[model samples]
Target: MSESSDLVMPDAADSERAAEAALRPRHLEDFVGQPVVREQLSLVLEAAISRGNVPDHVLLSGPPGLGKTTLSMIIANEVGGSLRLTSGPAIQKPGDLAAVLSSLQEGDILFIDEIHRLARTAEEMLYLAMEDFRVDVMVGKGPGATSIPLPLPPFTVVGATTRAGLLPAPLRDRFGFTGHLEYYDDDELATIVVRNAVKLGADLTQDAANEIASRSRGTPRIANRLLRRVQDWAQVKGNGKLDLSAARAALDVFEVDQRGLDRLDRAVLEAVCVRFGGGPVGLTTLAVSVGEEPETVESVAEPYLVREGFLVRTPRGRAATALTWQHLGMAPPEQSDTLFT
Candidate 1:
């Protein structure tokens, strides 16, 4: 495995720092997509910095790879504040959180990614730290123990979560502003591709940018990745300029269809339409039927499927839509209830 993959899934703090260092968006303008989030955050940061106080705790909720981490860094930069990275899962003990909290400077931004996974004890301590800028730290062993009252600097906590619904009500309510990041539109993703291409010093055309954007699965990171791959293809197979035809050919070779469905994406649809007769099936059943991980099916495959109207999420489970049948060159069943309704 790669060094990054073998890092034993370090605590949220280390993971957040690595993510910040590796893919931190350098400037507000360079941060791609989620324009509303940018505008809202800009207002909050400007207002807070103008008043010379840490901004209200910010809760950023979104699916993975939609720039939640990047936005957190951008907020820190905009406020001229240092960011201390951490996550919910990393905080195994209240003391772990107290150590981090006690070290923070006034007006510093503490970014907690995956905030939903925090330990219960740590979460309780954080409630006090967040609300009153103080943490009661336990000293020595149990029974004959002492609890030291430690005061923390006034710091802004920015929490990012893939599953915001899992966060407790008290924790969620503490944040003054909540920004929900949505998937990028194709145009926004195209702009993201073009921007990264310029940064990477690749020659990219408008049509090529659009083609790449269309197949980026509506994510800036994916758009950037695709751009890098296409650049490599251009270097070997054609002139270094990424023209539309070259982009299409490169993406085809990568098994990325024009509709943005990848090999695994097609596999899910194929399993449903071909194997399960266009399932109105449970997620576990579908996962087992397709021989893939259930989380992968829910996280990666289902997002695109629902976005493209090929799959529907019902109380009963996941079911293929009429669009799925049409896309797979099969007819919709007669006398069937509409999937969306």
Candidate 2:
């Protein structure tokens, strides 16, 4: 059996990296969608500046490519503070966190990506650092090791995570403001594409931009990537202008269908409807069957599948809906209930 025969989740770090590349908004104004978050973040920054103090810890939770890291940088810029970038996995021990916290200048911003993956010990250290600008360091050797309290510069912690549920309640409560980022709307994504095209000196027409946006999986990063690719195709195939036909041809070559089903997505449904007989199949078995990592199945494939009504999650596992069968060019099982119906 292939290694992916067992369910495996894609590496969270890898997903973060891809999302970061495609979607990290260059500025607060360019960050598309998430209106409520944008408004609230503005208020938070205003409050902090009015008082001339570091704002409360910010917790940003959302799916990948939603501009969490970009927002963190925006916050730092707005607050007139330098930002220190780190990740949960980077702070493996309390001492690692201590070093970061201790080095911060007053009113600095420390952005920790993937905060949910923080080591437990480091999480404990953060409580004190967040509440009080202090780090407790152990002094001396085994015979008389003593905890020494070290003062820290007043700084804001911007915590970004795709999995907020994994954060400890105590750590969660430490954040004074929490921002939940939502996926981009089609219009917002189109706007983002237009904005990026303007920056990149690409000739993207409105209809062409909209067409690419519609298939962007509601992600700015994907929209930007698609625009660049289509720009290349347009320059080579058509004129420099990315018109509708050029955009379509580019998407076709990229394997992103009109409905945005890539090879991985199609492979998922095919495995479900054809192999599992339209599943009520366990996740592990399905993952193993697909030769994909379970985590990838859960995070990437399942989100889109469920969103499109092609799959359903249940206590037993995942079941392919009638939509899945139809999409996969198969007839639904006679005995199965229509998941959408």
Candidate 3:
């Protein structure tokens, strides 16, 4: 699955990270989409800045490749706080979180990506710190352990998660403001593609930008990454012009379809339809058939497939829609008991 770099998930490679860093918007005004969240977040930051106090903890939830991390950085910038980046996996215990929290400089913003994955004990520790700016530290183990309450200066915690429902109610309730980010529309992604293309010094035409946007799977990170790929093709194969033709050729070379289905996505559909006879196949079976982790197939491939009407999820499992067969250029299978409405 990692071989399919265009699978709509954020790439963890250093090169991709460097590109994202270079192209990320530094200020709230420069953020490309999510108008409602932008407006509300701006108001919160403005009010907090005016009041000379740290803003309330912010919770941002969305799927990957959306702007949660970017928005968190914008929050830190707006609040005039240094951004401390970490992830839920990195904080394995209460002590791990304590080390991070105790080092805060009053106005610093600690951004926890994948916050929902935090250990329950660490989450319990966070509840007290977020609410009262204090943590009770244990000085010893067993019977000799002494609980020492430590007071902390006011700070902000910006927690970003792909699955908001997994967060505990106590931790979730502590966030004064929560913003849910949605996928970018084609027009918004088109604007972002064009803007980032210019930033990357590409001569991307408007139609080329639109083409990338349509195939970007409604994510700004995908749009920007595809623009970079198109730029590479333009430089190497298209006489240095990022025209519509170059963009189309590059996308075709990369095997991204008109509907943004990549090789993995199509493989999932092909397995369900051709192998399982338009399946109510279980997810593990589907992943095994397609040679992917269940998590990868579910998160990276299934969401867009389900969202775009190419696949359907049911109590039984996954089933292909009529469109999936047509997209695969195959005759529709006769309705079977496996099919669900």
Best model per TM-score: 3
Q: Which portions of model 1 show Cα errors greater than 4 Å?
A: 1-24, 331-341
As a TM-score, model 3 comes out at 0.93
**Model 2 superposed RMSD (Cα):** 6.0
Backbone clashes, candidate 3 = 0
The clash numbers for all candidates, in the given order, read: 0, 13, 0
**lDDT digits (tens) for residues 12-50 of candidate 1:** 679656633554476777777788988888898888889
* Candidate-wise lDDT, in order: 0.85, 0.85, 0.91
Q: Model 3: which ten-residue window has the lowest total lDDT?
A: 332-341
lDDT, candidate 3, 1-341, per-residue tens: 67577555555576677888888888999998899999999999999999999998999998899999998888888878999999999999999999999999999999999999999999999999999999999998999999999999899999999999999999899999999999999999998888888888888899999999999999988888789899988888889999999999999999998999899999999999889998889999999999999999988999899998898898999998888888999876566644443
Which ranking of candidates, highest lDDT first?
A: 3, 2, 1
Per-residue lDDT value at 167 in model 3: 94
